[model samples]
Target: MMSLNQVCPYCDITKINKDIVSVDHLLPKASFPVLSIFPDNLIVVCKACNEVIKGETIYLPIAHPCYEEVSRHFTFVIKENNNNKFTIEIATNSKNSKLINQKIYNFIKLFKIIDRYEKYMTAELQDYRTAVRTPNKCVFIELGQLTLLPPNLLLKRLFHSKFQPCFSY
Candidate 1:
């Protein structure tokens, strides 16, 4: 069995101390019985992202966010306007656009992650707004311009810090 501390191969979020949730097959195991035990087919995902993303579908061609280097396949774009509000856009049309879009849509609808995490996302947006408005000169100078990293990396870092013991084994 894979360790619970294993970073989610899909989201790259640490899963050490957090509730283990479940293992997700990169490919739907039931649909591909022959490859059910394939190492390449398995991924650890947080319960929220997994349950929300996995709907009725059995097969998805999109790269698993955890184990697979899916960052290469997608990009995030942030836009700010005169009103000073910011909007986040996840690029869906990259090399794996069709496949990725389908998987993303499925994930959004099935997992209801958007709805479930609306408050969290909103709070983060507010933080960004404050940062932009106040402009922390010292921190910005020391750290350099804060580039928004992908969600996977953010999740991974949060998971790692919060659940350090999970990585011990």
Candidate 2:
């Protein structure tokens, strides 16, 4: 399981809170029974994405977001004609091109992550636009300065502020 502070390794969202909808099998447990209980094979996911994307058998060769190096397998494409709609497209250089394509197709159908997350992402993007237009005071101070904090100081502060006493130590 990922730490609470860690974002969804798949969707790369850090805003996930206690309402953590479900556990995602990083390597679809149905296909890889041996890895079912593996720690790295599980991740926390928002209810919306989890409920929509799991529990199906499609003979696609796409790597799990957590298990496979997604950067090399897919790229996010914002369609120019679809009101900037975003979709993940398979990389042409992917070793198992056919399987990857199939996986991508099936994964989208299974998860319905496109339309669901698209609405959320669109709202988020709008928020970002608003932020850019009128920056928030708190965010402005922390934006580029996060890297300037000392490593120990950052760790201590993050743990102390974000976690319970057990994690704080």
- Per-model root-mean-square deviation over C-alphas: 7.6, 10.1
Give each model a TM-score: 0.57, 0.48
Local accuracy by lDDT, each model: 0.49, 0.49
* C-alpha lDDT (0 to 100) for residue 63 of candidate 2: 52
Error of 1 at 1 (Å): 5.9
Best by TM-score: 1
- For model 2 the local lDDT of residue 30 reads 77
| lDDT score of residue 29 within candidate 2 | 76
For model 1, how does the per-residue alpha-carbon lDDT over 1-169 read when each residue is reduced to its tens digit? 6666565554443344457566666567667778778887665677645565663354344445554455554444455546655455566545665767776655444444335434334455555445445533222211112125555544433233321211111
* Per-residue lDDT over 18-43 for candidate 2, one digit per residue giving the tens place of the 0 to 100 score: 77647777567777889889877666
